[model samples]
Target chain A: MLSSSKVKLIQSLNKKKYRQKYNLFVVEGIKNIKEFVFSNFLISNIYTTEPIPFMQEHQYQIISHEELKKISFLKTPHNALALVELPDTLPYSIQGIQIALDSIQDPGNLGTIIRLADWYGIEQIFCSETSVDVYNPKVVQATMGSLARVQVNYTDLKKLLTTSPIPVCTTDMDGENIYTSCLPQEAFLVMGNEGNGISEDIKSISNLKLTIPRFGKKQKTESLNVAISTGIILSEFFSQKEKI
Target chain B: MLSSSKVKLIQSLNKKKYRQKYNLFVVEGIKNIKEFVFSNFLISNIYTTEPIPFMQEHQYQIISHEELKKISFLKTPHNALALVELPDTLPYSIQGIQIALDSIQDPGNLGTIIRLADWYGIEQIFCSETSVDVYNPKVVQATMGSLARVQVNYTDLKKLLTTSPIPVCTTDMDGENIYTSCLPQEAFLVMGNEGNGISEDIKSISNLKLTIPRFGKKQKTESLNVAISTGIILSEFFSQKEKI
Candidate 1:
């Protein structure tokens, strides 16, 4: 059984302000809750339809389907939902290849990129202030347990790029072809907003402007989606590894 | 001003059952509305805050901001929202290089692929029946007006690949390295589901299995996002054209 106050607390997490005050975010669905149970994150609360062994480390409540449904954002409630404590603010660490986002607002894109970063073993991900809330439940779901492994921090993209010791590279249509561009092994790769591309301020800070050259045709497309572009660019880095 | 009945009608469009039964789908934003206006699609109704001269040829209705707000599904109501008559069911005439998706449920992926197809001039996209509804407002929004150019259809992916006249190639980790593989000028490239990759049932029909060779350390990423893989594979086709 969920207390009225507890239900209100869970609902309040949907807002950024509440999330800030509590330093907690909700992770919905069976797949996501299970992943969080094993990760290092502090499980503040667990609402489950059935017993889950991983939650043995943390206190949990066996809630009925109706009670679980009350707290679920999903129209069809999954078997479980969890409220996880956010990790400590990570310091800006520029080591190997890092991915940066400039005002990417979609939760799915942010989450998928986090997963991609985890997959490629990227050093870190830097997000501009306007990027989607990384702790958004949808993004956490999309990350597929990757949120535990990758370090994503929100920062001032333009300021960071200017002071960063490493070269900052960004993809642009008019830029040199990425296929032939001599990219450094350790660099900061910046992706821009879905509609606006990279901000003008950050664009000026980039050391190199590269492009994933499209095929010869009448391209009605104005630009590639930033996330998709990131994938291709990251693959280029990964493909090089396959050769050796 | 939106009448009570009209407001209710517009809100109903958010559901797939309504869209399918009425053979109508919503297209919002000034840019998208303008694009679809020029296309062959018939505009049934239009509600806008700003004036649209192109819409003179089609049947339209001017509504106040409050009325537009009542009907709009977007988080921030756009300048305009339109209801367009769904295009006539297009028969698949697979001729040149075509793209097929197996169980791709993300609207953004579907939209990005649609836009990419439009850029490369690949006219048709074949999706599994289980894929997200193409007319989902999110899908339409993500396409960025590419819906005007690309024709998308849902069908049995496995059956189509088996009988497709052109070669069917799907991306896989164990498959041949795509960078050096001899790719055909015209073939059907099948992309798999988001998490599961390609389904085995469809794999049975894959004639030429190709892989986008990963670079970096082998243990880094488990696999690439299907949409990112789509961009890379499509870029290669275009890359050859650039050489020409």
Candidate 2:
């Protein structure tokens, strides 16, 4: 049975504060819920309109479609919504081309970046405290199922860069061309905010600065989207790895 | 002054049929409007709350914030909005790397692709007739101002591929690794729909197939987002050109 208090609690999970307070995050859709079910994450509750074959062993409540609509963050509600316990943050020992996001405001951008990072075999991502919450529902939906595989850590970006053992690289306009540059295998590739690029302080501390050269004639395109830039840069880094 | 008739006309533009009937589309934000004003596109009217120094010679009307909210499509409306006449489609002579979008349904994906195309110096994009309208307000807003520089045309996808003189490359799972493949300087890189990917009919006619290899250990990520895939592939294609 769908209760008013349950619906209110589910709706409150949309905000970071509420999600943190409950120590749980919402994952919608049967496919996404299945991912969390199989991952290291723990599922607290599952609400669905129909019986899920894969989730038969888990405790779940069958609710009407109308009830699903009340708690769904999407414009079109998926068949299922699962409240999963937030996984405890594990200490990250970076061993590869880790991504560092500085003040990434858009949830969609952060989500897409995570999905791409998974495709490129990137295991970890470090985000500035100012970046959008990884548990944001819009972000969770956009990541598809990749979020379950990738590890995202939130920390102080400046301190992380300064204390790093390997080289720290930042994407810059006047930096060495990425196509010809000798990219390090082990490094922190820091991506900046959507509007401002990288912060001046972060840029000053970075050991290497690389750029994706533009081929457009008019030179009018202001910049590439942060997520798109991440994908392109990562593709290049991995492609170079294959050559060696 | 904002009239009821003007408000109705602007709101009607949100629909594809209405936009085609009027042969006009909406461009919001002072920066975006400026791009169209300087481009070959004709500006029908401009509505703003503040004086636009660049648009002083152009016909414009000052409207209050409440009135602007009624005419604007954005949740948070920018200072200016302009109606631009849709440019007549130009005959595209396949020259460099042209993009063919097969049944692309998402406006944001199309918009981001268009923006990236502009940055990569891809002058023309051909879309399947079933694809989402390029003039969609959501698409226009997402493109930033790249819509002014990049030309998007809609036509029969299968027919275009069959008639094309150069190689028609399609991104597929079983195709050649894009990192190692010999990419052509002049070819049509066809990106598929958001969900189903390139239609069967369109895929059958393609001369070549390309795939972005996944590095993730789990291989659980079903597929990269179509837009992100496009960016990665395009980056590789362009990077290869610099090597030659």
For all the models shown, what interface RMSD does each have?
3.4, 0.8
Candidate 1: which stretches are off by over 4 Å? Answer: A55-59, A90-93, A214-222, A240-244, B1-24, B55-59, B69-75, B89-96, B136-138, B172-185, B194-199, B211-225, B236-244
Which digits, one per residue and each the tens of the lDDT, describe model 1 over residues B184-234?
Answer: 877899998888888998888888899865433424344666777798787
What's the CA error at residue B233 for candidate 2, in Å? 0.4
Q: Model 1 Cα displacement at A16 (Å)?
A: 3.8
Give the best candidate by DockQ: 2
lDDT of 1 at B36: 86
Q: What is the TM-score of each candidate's chain B when compared with the real chain B?
A: 0.94, 0.98
User: Could you give candidate 2's per-residue lDDT for residues B1-244 as a string of tens digits?
Assistant: 7889989999999999999999999999999998898889999999998999975645788889999999999999999899999899887798778899999999999999999999898888999999999999999988989999999989998988899988999988999998888889878999999889999988898888999999998867869989899999999988888777
Where's the lowest-lDDT run of ten residues in candidate 2 chain A? A52-61
TM-score of each: 0.84, 0.98
Model-by-model lDDT, in order? Answer: 0.79, 0.91
- Residue runs of model 2 more than 4 Å from their true location after superposition: none
Quote the lDDT for B31 in model 2. 92
Q: Categorize the docking of model 2.
A: high
lDDT of 1: 0.79
**Scored by Cα lDDT, where does model 2 land?**
0.91
